[model samples]
Target: MGRHDDETETSYITVPSFFKCPISLDVMTSPVSLCTGVTYDRASIQRWLDGGNNTCPATMQLLKTQDLVPNLTLQRLIKLWSDSSGPGSSPILNPPSGTKVPTKEEVNESLNRLMTTLSRDDDVRIEILTRIVRFLKDSDTNREFLKKKKTEFITLLVGIIRMKTTTKKKMELVLMATKILDTIKPDRETLSNLMLNDDGGDCLTAMLLAIRRGDQDSKIEAVRVLDWISYDARSKLLVAEHDGVLTETIKLINVTDSDPSLIEASLSFLITISKSKRVGSKLIAAKVISKIKDILMTTEMTSVSVTEKSLKLLETLSSKREGRAEMCGEDNGRCVEGVVNKLLKVSTAATEHAVTILWCLCYVFREGTAAVERSNGVTKLLVVIQSNCSVMVRQMAKDLIKVLKINSSALSAYETKTTHIMPF
Candidate 1:
């Protein structure tokens, strides 16, 4: 463990993005949340406010209430994570051995209490829900025990969320509910009822609200819930048909200083929804192509997982003619160049996805040859043909070379054997 003191600090753990102060980008000393649902280190925000700034540093929203509530749950989470990682982890964070889980009765009572506590302050409700989310996240046993009461909890949560309430009063509750549903992973039939015509789409509507107005956690959970909801065949169309779901999700990608986890969730959700052909044109209409290019072009902001998924999503979108045209035609050479760049740069999965995309554009469609040639894609293709890549990838690389009308005889210098025949 790295030494920790009052002012300067260093640590081995890769601190969670949210754990760091927005202004300082260091692990928060005393984390606090503002009215806008953004959290920051006490000293950093205090300095910001002392500098005569009236807007939130993160959202730039005009300050309505400058009240800074101590984010006790977050503080505890940080401590728990720190303790767990820094050599002397508490039993709660990393249990020594498994023990008996809570009985069904105890779980039911807790759900019933949350259901009946309408008059309870929002703070209490959030705290209770936070503990539950943390507990569920800790291990599989906690999750499995809670799974038995998943239906009751979901029903109660639905009722609580559906109440006539103002946005400010209910956002936390709704967000927590979304997180719970996302964690518990309710059955497809249950999600279909809540997200589709059968149940008036209340849950789905709340998801949009979370995406639009919620804090970072809420936004991530919202997309996560939608990602799960999209898995049900009926809900995929509902998600696509919803006027704002696709638009709002695309908006998440463009937020200034956007969280990578949120973007990852958004990309995953888009991938799931993109499986249906009906949403392909709509996604293109919403400028998803440009947004994805922005992701691929910036290797710094994205994680390897994000890179892999982006390529996969791009490949999925390539199945549409408009998607292909947008990438190879309207985008000049950037799109093809990005694909070529990933040929040997990323993982095996990413390389696989990239070659498939290149093949579609340069070979199958025959419209991307100029773009590929401009990108020196032939060089990348030749490299792929000679790499220790999958057999399918090697063949696709050669086919792409032929499409560009490049001579394959040059392979003799690189490959000892004919690519047309097997190598021992």
Candidate 2:
């Protein structure tokens, strides 16, 4: 939604607070009044009832009945507010009504009409795309119908994105197209087709453009689409080969002010792309290791999923010599120390990857072997062996300890001293 007003006038337009559903915190499409005198979205309240919650979400009071009284008057007023488009008022698209699911024939006709208009008029194309996005968002049936024409739909959306237009209306069209494509989630076959075609590359280029120039919502959608494409191995390499793809992704990860979803998407893409040795080297050259270390050091990165991903990427990067060198400090040993500390602190998967990284450092790089000794990593490796870790992890820890004991006589003395106290 938006606001429109004359430059000389002082007018503020906003959504009425009461129009929002308390449960969902979004504008209520089907308003229902409970016995608690609280109005909520019908679907949200139904889900609450289905979850066996007899208490109201807002008031925390027991409900006399699960019956939802439709607030027809309030619904009419909300509809009127949404439809009132004028100066200082923005048009809010209403969610699809439950009773108004379009049939297959109607959907096909609309798709045909949209394709026909897309080539001639950008404004009309945007309007059609808005209606399509609303339909796809509100009704699963509409989405299923569109899935039948997935290739055609993706082709049209890519065309819209490739079209050169700097006008606000055209950008809106591109944003809507991107949103619709994300929602549709084209199948693997369709995605493969897009990749094989030159237009597919253009589609990727357009998404990258959106990432650089579009708003947060558009940027998030673009990232998601790229994530989808990166699912397949060939597609992942294709994306990695595209110029500025990895660079933009690393930049997105380093962005201090970004949505968590954006960061997660970038991390997901990196994890996927890191599977390739060539791309892994490129990522290390992009300073992805330092970026990941910074992310791991952040207190806000508390999600186990994010931690696991970061560790996974680090493990991949550590496979390369340059990656290992970057993670292994010159003489201070902070880089290797930071990784060795994660041995038993994080989740099991994270611990496994952490150990894997330390293993790479100790065995792959000669400097890493000495650095671990100086950072007291041998003590941590002994602790890992004694701790309740997996068979594979324990074995890896044992292997590293053996190598350390054979290579560094000081580690051998430390092991002998602690062997009785902490048996391995």
Candidate 3:
């Protein structure tokens, strides 16, 4: 006879049975993981069963105590049963012994139980969602499942994003959602309504703020989303309609340190608007040139990598005709001079940053030949070429020296010709 109900409770927490074994599917006998934390150990179950009670130690399910058998026989049966099954079978379960049986109803029941657990609690939801997303990566049919649940998935992700809680949890959810969204390949038609139905100016503003709030990973993800929206053709056209987007991007670069990815993204966004003179004018009017100058001139003697990238970006900025005009013009010329002085100083002092600085100098001189001549930039550059240790920097410096000399000769010939042809 079964033990007293209270006895069963204690035994349930302690023993294992045939039902708990592979025979009846209670607690696993000697649970061993085939993959991840999922297990199929019959020994643990058999040990519990060996304790004289036939109850699943894990779930408290009753089992056939009479079916006690050695581990070798169970292993043999497991191999024989699995071998008889068809090409496809559950990775966790061994094949059936007597016949190939379908468990559609049982599988669905287990999934229903899991779904209930997932929906009833936030922690359970996050855990379940994490596992399912990982499983989806392995399953070919997950695409179909995702297509069917696209709206639901997006809604769930939006809910998580909106949830007010710890930053870590929020970031975890963000990463999960981004991975799933990428896998599912959700259409813009979905996010467009939530992210773009507004003028999108507000959405852009909010994303920028979120980017600054979290740590590196969160900010990187945030930047990805912003870059997606910022560079989208439709959004790009729409953003171009208002000057605020360009102004905000320029401001972001100015305030944020030299993040190469962000700088590159901002530069790309700037490139998109450069197609239109009005957009370019708006970018210029927003003081992009001055800010770029500031970035280029920063001589904090800290964060050399950032300074290197800033120098490269400065070269890019100063190369543009509009950029050069702004650089050589009244209010901004001093900024350019400051940038040149820093590049020269770093060239002599910092071997590594020196090469980059010299490379950028070459780019600036090459692109802004007229501006360099007007600003008398050649003499300073020549001094660096004569003394710098970095070979590339010296080479670039020498190149600029050659260009300045050639221009000087051309200017002299023109002047001499003009003098000889006086009164013509």
TM-score winner = 1
Instruction: Give a tens-digit lDDT track for model 3, residues 34-63.
Output: 212223354543444464644443334455
Q: Please provide, for model 2 over 297-345, each residue's C-alpha lDDT reduced to its tens digit, 9 standing for 90 to 100.
A: 6656456776778788888787787887787763355566666656677
Q: Residue 264 lDDT in model 3?
A: 51
Please give, for residues 1-424, the per-residue lDDT of candidate 1 as tens digits.
2223343343333456677665544577699999999999898787667757777876678889888899999999888777765454322321122221223343454455465532144543564465567667767877877777756677766655555446575777888777877777878577656555454466667778888888988899889877876765567888777769999998887534688888888989999988888887889888888887887777575678878888998998887889988887666857767877777887888988998898877777787788778878888888887788777678777878888887768755554433543210
Candidate lDDT values, in order? 0.73, 0.70, 0.49
Which stretches in model 3 have alpha-carbon errors above 4 Å?
Answer: 1-194, 197-206, 237-279, 300-325, 330-371, 374-424
Residue-pair clashes per candidate: 0, 0, 14
Q: Which pairs of residues clash in candidate 2, taking residues 3 or more apart in a chain or in different chains?
A: none
* Candidate 2 local lDDT, residue 34: 93
* CA RMSD (A), model 2: 16.8
Evaluate model 3: give its TM-score. 0.42
Off by over 4 Å in 2: 1-109, 139-145, 199-201, 231-234, 330-333, 364-380, 386-388, 406-424
The 10-residue segment of model 2 with minimum total lDDT is 415-424
